[model samples]
Target: MMIKSLLRISTVKVLILLAGLMLMFAIACGGDDDSAGDSAAAPAAEKKAEPTVVPKKSVHEEAEKKDDSAASGAAATATVAAAKKDEPTATAAPVASSKYGGTLNWGTAPNNNHVFFQQYTPGAGAAWAMNIGDPLMAYGKGSEWLEAKSMAESFEVSPDGQTITFKLKKGVKLHDGTDYNAPLHKWNLDWVLNPDNAAVTRPQISAIDKVTAIDDYTLEVHTDRVYTPLLNALGMMGGMPFSREEYESKGEDHLKTYGSSSNGPFMIEEWIQGEKTVFAANPNYHQKDTYPYLDEIVWVEIADEQVRGAALETGQVDVADINSKSTDVIAALRNADDIFEAKGMAGVRLSHHNAARAPFDDIRVRQAAQMAIDRHAWNDILQGGEGHVYMGSVLPPTSAFAYKVDEYMYEYDPEAAKALLEEYAAEKGLTLPLTHMDAFKCTDEQLEIGCTDLEKREITVTVGKGAANAARAEFEAAAFNAVGFEVTMDIAAGKEGPRTFVTKESSFSLRGFGVRPHPAGSMDSYMGYGGYWNNGSYGTSDAQMELHETLKLAGQAFDYQEQVRLYKKCQQIYLEHALGGVKLANAPSYKFWTTDLRYDGYPDFTEVFFPSDTSLKMYGMYLER
Candidate 1:
């Protein structure tokens, strides 16, 4: 299928249908607003940032068009960009018209997984944890997605590209009053790098060999190799500082529930799981001269899309994240007056095949599974025809190196898939109604609640608590079963998170991967040899090995054109060889905030949220009223 045709959507018709159908529902669901908490921290001493106009066009779309050049330029100039000590990026003075204080009630879905253990949970708790901590670097200003100074005041890369020396800002302290210095930064990186921790983002920073603190405010990072994406990795969650003192004293269990010290703009004030998380402005925030305009930011859990939208419409909540799955609700929000909306590519949903076991171990089986999926139907069913583009090995269509789905993906062809599966079955002498055994484990709580049938003859899949996952599982089961296979989907009845989803014992499973800072990140995380995410589906085939090698070369390449060329080759290799799983579909993320809230220098939500941190310089944000 042509990439243009795949992305073609009747935007006018979709908007019209959604607005006409869901407008009444949204209006009727409006309810009373929650009470705002009192401000404890005194007002910031510094002036607000200067007012800047935010464009209507999605930054994600613009990024897709500009990244090819930006990424190449960064890579080409890596060696020439000498090491230098510089001051932190300054925030210009805020406009006199801007007002300063109000609670920002944000709406989002509830997370049932581990809280405060960000390295483990990619769900709700992780979001809160990110907001609690801060990172070393962040996405640069404007639409370009390059790394810039954040916590680390300045940095200089060694001429060889294997080491990075950082100059940390002085006088910064965590919520518990621990010094936020080079030693603390090294400790944080070590925590993430520890194999026993099993941080979900470990692969992103795995290239780092070690970190050395040259002094209280100076640190050096040594990588195992050239590791081109190191800076980008540091700007993400893995590089966020975590206090070693708290971990040693408070213990992991205690910190997991009640957060530790924070060096970020916000500190955790209260957390009532499944209900809400409230964060107060950090009085000792490093950039105290100007930020965290809001007194408190509350993340209220409203899993229902319609109600979440209604909350925003009725002024109950100042901001809410709209899931594209609920097309009508999002459409209504988009058409709503006096609301500012920022859109970005969230991530892609793909089926992660278990290559460690049969039948996914066979390339033909993997290829057949890929061909069996009805991408268009799945997209419509999951996203309500929101016009999300199909994803490839590399994603978001905005990474420095990305390709059209057709260039490195299989088209939906159930007939061919059925033929291939039949040939495979005949060759392997397999029988109908093949009993697939999924290795099942139970949590202690689940076991206490009477868990049974720890092992079963079905393809076990884990998903959220809703109709969406069930429908998706059904669609997937029907597709594969129709194409010559007796696929019985055993929805894991206990946990509704990734713990069950990532197990290698399942006959097969579906996993959703979020957007990464770089294309090499996407490649290595899912397809690299012995990659952390590539757990069950270890890519060991000759073609898979070649793809991994190509990725390594691309990671080390300094020439912009050479990097692009090598990445393209990596994509071609992924296309020719089914790397662990098949690319399915992707979705767009939308951020909606009421007109009452004003931002002085509001960064893109994609940048803030994607890193799974509160990179928002909230000090610049305030309520007009």
Candidate 2:
């Protein structure tokens, strides 16, 4: 299921570039070690007697002088080495080896609710679900190709690529002692695919035609057509299996309330809603001795970054995913040698504008809003200079479909923004409200910057509450002018939100969408018809129709050249129609962990297998003694 058309640059090049940038940053920050000593010693120097002046030399004499100068240079180098005895010795403490049987205390941001199959479930909740149950396929840690390997066992795909047959690993059992067999697999697939279930991941498997159990150990899945991303989607939330017995016993409403059963390395021990979730190692895990080195894992819900950092420092939490937006927390973590950071540019931020709503319905107003915010300054201040100014596409430069356009539609120019706002005001004679969630640093800052610019142009800008779904509803009902919100990397790619945004076409809101590895996966969600977050229905323009058609073709096309061409065309249409709203900044996903947490036999970071934060293999991680 791998495509070879994308840019093939190695991770080593990225590492080298990062190293070079760090060195340059250090130098620029006046990190020279010898400066203080040199300054102190310079003032003590006294004038020395001048040596006898030398006359102009012949060619032979000049050659001799050059040889003597080289000798003096070697002598000077030796003298400098001898003078370096006063320098302080630097050393790092060695890390201790991994030891088994200790509880790992992890911390993450809390959410209002936690549900396995819902769209609004938090990232931490999703990570917990993965811990409790295995995806049919798993990607290796830091796998650049996004290769999929069978988590349970091997599988074969039909020649036509319409059918996938899985061979289940023997002797596997769920936490409730139910055998993990073909019937169980078929049940889970049917539940997700069933329209009445309203599974948030239903769109991921919309192409699937049927699922049948051939036997107790084998299952066959048939698709309507060749869907390339089916495996990737299955490797996510859609593939998560829940016990059929529990579903029938407790019913759908209470399944999550009773602590779902686990077929993976860990099982839920306790879940204290809004506080924490405790998991215990499942000794009967199918993977045998490969995982669950730790006896227990306690995931503490700590939304405040500073509080989380303090917990890590005070040995309250063994590992925590600190926020990149919290500069102080990141600084503190970097200062502590016991903490390790796993960093990579995994996502980007974008403002989703409602083109159907007035004010934003005017393309000039949308362009003006985009130009009003200073992304560079936002990156420096909010991300602590760890982010890049984002162009108006969800795909990063690494993606194959990422094409360089000749013109930047909206560069940071407050004067231009002011002119646009003035023109809009003169035409409409109405004040607009700029709203954002105060909880998120990026959106909060964007609202402030945008509002300040509009005010400068003699336009009235009002601030509104920052709730995501609530804001969308209010905007859809025409209760507010504009709302600013932050969209997580996954949600941006998945396109999860209220249906009314597409159905009613009443409100225009601004929010960011993160980057995806592939253009088809990212673009199709926003532009394709029947997509979860397709705001294109808000406008019936020819450009919008062309964008939708191009994106649809790009999603279905297997030919690399055709896919790239179609995606590029779609991007052009999107930009031309000003449908993508405002592009903000792209930042690396920064995860910090204590040095004490160790993975027995896993890479530090896995691009697809591991959760968004922490390098410790979800199952293989152990604490050092």
Candidate 3:
């Protein structure tokens, strides 16, 4: 009876201790009488479970916080240097440790016509498209331009400079898993050379007489003459090899909508129209061991320039496109802490006058028009004082073969221009109010006046897009009107001036001339006989013929000094004759990116344009964030 009583008392004491502990736990958890207290404690518990995001402590951070307009240019440059302190300055990957596995968000202009076939599109547009193939050679991989080897392991030109032998890399495969052999290379060359194909790049390689495949890995190229720019032309756009079998089976327009196979470091995964283009890393890439550090690259289309610039500042985008010619844009970028710029190739602005039609067909009129252009005004007003007006022809003033500024002779002299026009009018017995018709619109029978009033003396000038071009068109019209020629402006249907010039749809238009790697490549395309862009028969005059002949001699000369001498002679003749059109100005192009996007392994990172970059710079690039 006593043991039972003791056990009952011990059980009651243990129950009391357990009840006290439960009350203490409830109080710690905020399970009190007040409902607000419980709600606050619940949020505290959830906050502890969330992950933390650590911000990078970079110099760009301090610069971004400071007002950009107040800071001096020296301070801006120093900030850029500091932002790149931990990054590799050279193109090659750094010897230090690297961390990978991130996505790169790039913002760019929209690819209006999304065509993958290089032959159908312009080189700049094609480069912006999904690059799935490799070129024969590429720039930016070496210290100098146009000196890097790509798909071709090695190449040599014969002592005579008429033939070239290329030893292709053996293990390369096309996007469609086809062997990239000599036969494939031969087929591509044949396709381009065929006149029926109407390949846009045919004129660039017109000197090629034949292509012979010695073996699966060896190929030989023979030119009609000593074509020294063969390597540059072959290594540039429209030279990348595609699968013939795929084209034969799937058809030519298949690449317009479908994603093609790629042998490069990255392959197109998906391209949402007007949205974004995604590129996935190639697992079987040739340089898989050390390259393509990013798992994927997402290119977003941001049409608005201001929004694109803001995206970079907010860290929403890694890389972006910035207009290097805009003073406001340049100033804003310089003020921004994290943003940096890499200068690329220069662009030459040209005024194309139709030689096949009236007015421009007259040498006196062409020379007078060329002399009336104010290049300095264009440099100051259109290019924000960042343009080179010393250009003589297709090549920019920066090129080694280009004519010096002092050698240029087309000075702005409206009085002298008027005298030449007056001489032509008096010689032709043409009156001041004589009407000039749009001859291109009329049939052969109605060619005389083309339904135009004979009393009016108006000449139509086709104007391209952009505020600068509009301003130039107005200036040109006023300049022509000052010489007793009534002027009218016709806005171009498309922004493409070359196509309009080739079709002869307009008597006068403004065209953008891209400077080629070699001087001859540009000269042959625009001025050579039977050239793709030589629709107006530019070298028809005896003076122009002399210029063309000099260009040929320059193209064949092996010695650099001899080539320069001949090229200078050609420029002098071109200016004297005013062949093709007026050379306006040369503007610089640039590539912009945030500090987190690192460009390693690209020796000439600032030399080549980003859209058409083929130096395999993307292989060694990575994201630091």
Candidate 4:
């Protein structure tokens, strides 16, 4: 009875949370208003059109709100030490004991949070909600998929495997004064399937049909379908329980500011919007003495990538974002008096194209795009040789399951691209006609004119199949022009920039450059042609669509042997016919982290201080001298 009362958070923000805001233009990015079943459900179309959202402030406005507007490294260190200033900090089940305290500040390229991600306040999103906040079952930095017990003292999975029960560690307290008890902390996965929550919850708990708590420390989860990675998901923000008092106070997009923790190793003491967010170590943090090596963290957001690079070089910031777009930054860091450091993760790019469209509406067109780009050259230039090129629809070949069969899409042939252009032209019927959006491949000056302008829509793409977006834009412009077809490459900015053409299906074809969630071994990633990512909306060759369910089920199979068998089958699916969006070169995921802040996953800073964290697990991370 006590548990139910505490857990009963009024459906205060539930209405606003009708769907997710993972995409920048969450409502605009989607196609339909009523299709809630799709993970990224479209917003109900507005009865009256709304004006575009213009940024009233700078990208780093929130970070600038802090006291340490210029340099934050010292303030960040003070954060860890600040945690000790509260209560003498303790060691418990989740966070193993260690006596390190200091604040760590970090930055994200897209340094802001949206509505769908309100509950998750980390830089990346809900994915890092664990250690910094709460992990129903935290992933001890070292363990892969195996959740390290945190707020949960110990746990047991039901014999049927659909349900998982957790034993709560005693005397757990939220960053707020409220204490955590069973029913309050307990939530049913079934809520995710509820018609009310269905559209919003589909992406997070697709495998979960129900959740129930038998006791305070024990939970029972029942799956309508076989769910193998449910535990891993539990170690994420989706599984982190919300505080009743804290959740209801924020306004409009208020949920995004629901800042209070139940069991993460660190506690965000204060968030000075546009300045710096201060994260004090959690005195009651389960990981005793081990947490938050520095004192209080003063996380500042610097919008200009160049400025961020400069900050790190001058020690104004400890770490910053790195990826294909930041080649110049990487070079500067490497050349910086050995003071700068960088690390990268390969095989991380996924191609997103509308399944129900022209150009991409044809599988051959999609294949041509995959083969047109000089992937290695792009990686060599942008990723600085740290990147890996992949034609297959999976991570890298390093994994046992990635389909390394016939190296199908590696041919960077413009000739072939030219041939595919003819097929599209022949099919679409060209009356010596050219139609295109003037927005794409345009300089900032050209975009002001808009895509529909009949006069300036055509462009001469000189860079033959450039790299990534540049390559894609050039190929699209070149392809259509070859056959006297018109082209449109919409380059909108803000959340809607890249997808401006895609949402409207206007570009020759678009690449949705975002990474969706999936454990390393899961083959059903958006990259792989699994259910939600089935390319049906973009363009699925008949052969590729047939393997949909096979890969989906194989993706969930906990049995290693069965999963391997299905993976082999799924790879064949892609090889037979290129899916609508073909895998180009995986953008190298980079992390330039400080050696002092210890944690898992190479410089993931969502939890290091406080901003937006979906899943945060602090382990093996202690401050160095």
The candidate that wins on lDDT is 1
Q: Residue 266: error of model 2 in Å?
A: 1.1
Regions of model 4 farther than 4 Å from truth: 1-99, 114-123, 126-128, 140-149, 188-204, 249-252, 258-262, 270-276, 338-342, 427-486, 497-545, 594-622
Q: Per-residue lDDT tens digits of candidate 2, residues 1-625?
A: 2322332323332232212111110000000001100000001111343111112121111111011111111110000111212211222222433455789898876742644433323334445666677767543331122222234465566656577777777777888888778899889889887756666556666678899999988888888866655654565556767678877887766656556674877888777777987889988987665566678888888878889988988889977776556778877777775666655443355445555444455666666666666767666755677755665434433333443343456667766665665566566654333332111112354333211111111112211222332432332223112222222212222223342233322123333343222333345555654444444343444555566666656555545444445555565556544565555565545566665555633232333223222223456566666
What tens-digit string does per-residue lDDT give for candidate 3 at 296-387?
A: 87778887777787888788888776554456765676578767666443545666765545666676777677777787887787667665
lDDT of 4 by residue, 1-625 (tens): 1112223223322111111111001100011011111111111233444222111221111111112111211111101111112212122112423335555566544433532232332224432333356656544322222323356655555445555566676677777667776676654333334434322223445566656767765665667765555554555555665555565454424444535445665566655454555556767765664454556554566666677778776666665665446678766766565242433223334334444344344555555555556666655754566555654434332233333433343366656665665656666674433353223132344333221112223322222122344654554455445544454454432333223221323333344323222332223433233233233322233444455566566545655434444544554455434443545454444445443444433233423222111122333345444
Candidate RMSDs in order = 16.3, 17.9, 26.2, 15.3
- What is candidate 2's local distance difference test score? 0.50
On TM-score, the leading prediction is 1
Cα distance off (Å), candidate 3, residue 605: 3.7
Q: How do the residues 39-146 of candidate 1 rate in per-residue lDDT, one tens digit apiece?
A: 111112213341111112211111121223333222110001101222112242345455555688888877534345445555334345545666776443221222
Error of 2 at 487 (Å): 19
- Per-model lDDT: 0.57, 0.50, 0.54, 0.42
Model 4: per-residue Cα lDDT at residue 124? 46
RMSD of 2: 17.9
lDDT score for residue 546 of model 3: 59
Q: List the residue pairs that clash in candidate 2.
A: 141-606, 142-606, 142-607, 350-512, 352-511, 435-484, 437-466
Model 2 regions more than 4 Å off: 1-99, 115-120, 142-152, 357-362, 396-407, 418-511, 514-522, 534-540, 560-572, 600-603, 606-617
